[model samples]
Target: MSKKGPRLGEPASLVRMRVVPIASVMFASALPLMLPMIANSPALPPLGLLFFLCWQLLRSEMWPVWIGLPLGLWDDMFSGMPFGTAAGLWTLASIAIDYSSQRIYWRGFFHDWAIAAFLVAIIQSLAALIAHPHAPMGRVLGLIVPQIVISALLVPLFMRLTGKFDNFRLKRR
Candidate 1:
C-alpha cells in the first residue's frame, strides 16, 4: 500500500491540527510591532487585518462570527490605535464577509482579490474616520492611501500563505 496519511493506527492530535492556523494568525497580528522599520508615513500595512480576511475567505465557516472580537482585541494590544477600534472594525468586516459569502459562490483568485481590496478599503476608511474624527474626510482618506495600497497588494501573498497553512493544518500528522 502507498504511504499517505499517518501509518495504520497512528491518530492525529486535535491540537496538532489546530496550532498552525491559530499560530499563524497570532504571529501576523504581532509582526508589525516586532519589526524595526520606521516609515515616513504613519501608515503601516495592516498585516493582522490582511491575514484575518484571507483566512476567513479561504476557510469560510471555519470560525464563528465573534472570532474577530478576540482576535481584534489581541490586535489592539499590539496595534497602537485607540482601544476598541480594531475590534469594532474587525467584527464588522467579519459580519460583512459572512453575509456576502452566502450570496456568492465559485470564487476564483481574482474575485477573492477584489473582495479583499474592497474590504480593506472599507476597514481602513472606517478606521481613519474613527481615529481622526475632526479631520476633513478627504484628508483622512488621503492619509490612508498608502496603507490601503500596501494592504491591498499584499492580499495575494497572505491568501497564498493562508492556503498553505490551511492545507498543512489538515494534513495527517
Candidate 2:
C-alpha cells in the first residue's frame, strides 16, 4: 500500500458503502416531486427515476426495499395511484434487484443503464396493468417504449454526473 493514509480509490470504496445508502433514501424521498417536470417534458422521460434507483442498487449500498416502500407510498399519494400499488411494485422491484446483485457486476455503467431501462419498462407495464387492466397491450407498449429508450440513453450520462457528486467529499478528504 502507498504511504498516503488511503489512496483515492481505497477511500472511495470505503466511503461509498455508507454514503450511497443514505443518499439513496434521500433521493427516493425527493423523487416524486420531480415527476411532474419529467412527465411534462417531451425530451425527458419517467425512467430518469429508474436510473437513480439503479444507481442506488448497483452501488451495493442500501437495501432499496426499505427506501422503496415509503418512497412508493409517497409516490402513490402524490401521483394519485391506488394506495399501496406503487409501494408494492417498488418494493418488489427493489427486492428483485437485491437478489440479483450477486450475479451482476454493476460497475459497468452501460450495463447498469440498460438494466435501468429494462426495469423502467417493467414498471410501466406493471403500472398500466394495475391502472387499466382492460387497456390494449399495444397502447401501453406505445406509451412506454419511447420513454424506456430515452431513459436508457440518458441514464448513463446521469449516472456519470451523480457518480461525480459522490466523489465531491472524497476530493476534499
Candidate 3:
C-alpha cells in the first residue's frame, strides 16, 4: 500500500512560505533593541546585525551581495538610524564576506567566530560614529566596547538558532 502521509518531496507552496520566515526572523531580531529598556541600556548588542551575520555565514549561498542593500534599508527604517548607515555597512559586510570566501581556503568554528568579532567591532564602531558624529571619541569608544563584546559573545547562540532555521528550511514534509 502507498504511504498515507506527506510525500517525501518539496512542497508546492513553499516558495513564499520559506522567504517570509527568513525576513520575519531578521525583522523580529531587531525589535528587542528598539524597546525603551534595551535601547537605553548601556550595552545592548546589535541583535539584528548578529542574526544577519550568523545567517550569512551559516548559509553563505542563501544571500547574494545585492540582498544586503534592501535588508540594510529595512534595518535603517526600523532602527531610526540615518538612511544609508546600515545599508552601506551591510552591503560592505556582504561584499567582504564574498571576497573572503573566495580567498580563504580553510574555515572552522574558531575562524568564523573571530571573523564575526572583527566584523561586529568594525560595524559597531562605524555605526557609533555615524550616529553621533559630534560625540567625544572617548564616550563613543566606551559605549562601543561593551556593545561589540556582547554581540560577539552571542555569536554561538546565533549560530545555533541559524542552524535550527536551516534545518526547518530544508526539512521535507
Candidate 4:
C-alpha cells in the first residue's frame, strides 16, 4: 500500500464522536432566559431561540422534525413562558421549516433571513402572550417587539458562528 494516510473526498471509517447539535442548540436557547444575579430587567434577547433557528435554517439535515419536542421542553423549563408554550411553538416552527424546505425549490441567505425574522417575531409574540395572557395589547407588544428585533438582528451573526461550528463538526478526523 502507498504511504498516503488518507485520500481526499474520503469518508472517515472510524466513527467520530461529536457533541449533539440539538443539545448545544437547546442549551443556547436557554441561556437568554436565565435570571441574573442583579435582577434588574428581563434577560436579553433569547439567544437560544436565535441559535436554534440558525441551526435549523443553516443545517436542516442535522435536525429532525421531532427534534423540537425535547428542545422545546428544555426551553420551557427555563423560559417561564408556560410549560407547553415553547414546546408547541418550537415543534410548529420545525414543521414549518420542513414544509418550507419542501415547497421552496431554491433558497438564498436573504430568503432565510426573512423567514427567520418572521419566525422569531411570531415566537417572541407567542411567548409574551403566554407569559402575560391578560396583559394589554400594547403591553405585550412593548414587551416582545424589542426582543424580536434584537433576535432578528442577531440571526446573521449566529448563522455565521453556527456555520463555523458545523464545519468543525463535519471535518474529517
Candidate 5:
C-alpha cells in the first residue's frame, strides 16, 4: 500500500466507508443541475434523490438520520428550490425509508421500486406545490406527473447503479 493508503487506481478506503458514499451522493445530487441543458423539463426527474434513496434501500443502515441534512443542503445549493426544500424533504424521506425498512422484512427489487416510486411522487408533488403555492393542487400535480413517472420508472436503474458504486466502494486494495 502507498504511504497515504491505496494507490490512485486501487479501491477506495471503505474501512471508513463514509467518504465514498458521501462523495457519490453529493456528486449525483449536483450532476443534473451541472449539465448545460438548452431546455429543462419537469420530466428530467430527480435523479439525485433517486440515487440517494437507492443507496439507503441498498444498505438500510449505511447512513445516520442526520446524513440527509448536509447532502440535501448541497442539493439545495444547486436545485434552485427555495433553499432547505431538499434538506427538509430528503431528511423526511430518509426517516420514512428507515421506518419502512424496519416494518418490512423482505425488500425485494420490485418492492423497493414500488416504495421508491411512492416517495418520488410525494417529493415531486410537494415540491410542485411549493413552487406554485397559489395554484390548484391539480395543476401542480399535472405539471409534476411526468417527473414522478420518470423518476419512479428509473428506480431500478438507480438501484443497479448504486449497487455498482457500493461494490466499488467496498472493494479492498
Candidate 6:
C-alpha cells in the first residue's frame, strides 16, 4: 500500500500564507528610507520597491488593506512628502495592480521591469510636481532619468532574489 501523507500532487493544506506578504510589505516600506544613506552613487529608483509590492498584491494571497496602509505610512514617514501622500499613492497603486493583474502577465523579467519603471516615473513625477511646483523641469528630468535607468538595470536581479526567497519559504512550509 502507498503512504497517504502529503504528496507532490496534493493540494497545499496550509492556511496562513501571511508571512511572505507581511515580510515583503515591511521590507518595501523600509527601503525608501534606506535609499539616501548610500552615498556617491546614483539614487535607487523607488520602482523596485513598487514592483515587489505590486507582485505581492497580484498574488492575491493577502489583505491589501493590511499590506497597503502600513506600507504607505512608512513611505510617507520616510519620504519628504506630506504625511500620508506616499502611502496614499502606494495604496492606490496596489489597488490598481490588483485590479489589472488578471489582464497582465508577468512572464518576462524585462516586461515586469518596464512596467515598474513606467509606474515609478509617473508616481515620482506627480509627487515632485505636487510637492514643489516651482522646481525646474530640468531638475526633475535629471533626477528621474538616472534613477530610472539604474532601476531598469537592477530590477531583474532583485526580482530573482525575491522570487528565490519566496520559493524557498514556500518549499519549507
Top-TM-score structure, candidate number: 1
Give lDDT: candidate 4, residue 15: 36
Ranking of predictions according to lDDT? 1, 5, 4, 3, 2, 6
In candidate 5, what are the lDDT values of residues 26-91, reduced to their tens digit? Answer: 888788777768554464778778888888889988898777788889988877788888889989
Worst 10 residues of 6 by lDDT: 10-19
Error of 1 at 118 (Å): 0.6
Candidate 4 lDDT (Cα, 0 to 1): 0.77
Q: How many backbone clashes does candidate 6 have?
A: 1
Query: Pick by lDDT: which candidate is best?
Result: 1
Better structure of 3 and 5 per lDDT: 5
Error of 3 at 147 (Å): 0.9
RMSD each, Å:
2.7, 5.4, 2.5, 2.9, 3.9, 4.4
Angstrom error of the Cα, residue 99, model 1: value is 1.0
lDDT of each: 0.84, 0.62, 0.76, 0.77, 0.82, 0.61
Task: Please give the lDDT score at residue 112 for candidate 5.
Answer: 91
Which stretches in model 1 have alpha-carbon errors above 4 Å?
1-5, 8-12
Candidate 6 C-alpha lDDT tens digits along 33-150: 6654754433666643554554553354545544566766766665666877676666666766666566765545555667666666666777666676788988866766777677
Sequence-dependent TM-score of model 2: 0.67
* Candidate 1, poorest ten consecutive residues by summed lDDT: 9-18
Q: Using Cα atoms with residue i matched to residue i, what is each candidate's TM-score against the true structure? A: 0.89, 0.67, 0.86, 0.86, 0.87, 0.70
**lDDT for position 107 in model 2:** 43
lDDT string, candidate 2, 100-155, tens digits: 67776544656666667677778766876787678898876776677667766766
lDDT digits (tens) for residues 18-38 of candidate 4: 364665677786666554544
lDDT of 6: 0.61
- As for TM-score, the candidate ahead, 5 or 6, is 5
Off by over 4 Å in 6: 1-16, 31-42, 57-66, 105-108
Q: Which ten contiguous residues of candidate 2 have the minimum total lDDT?
A: 39-48
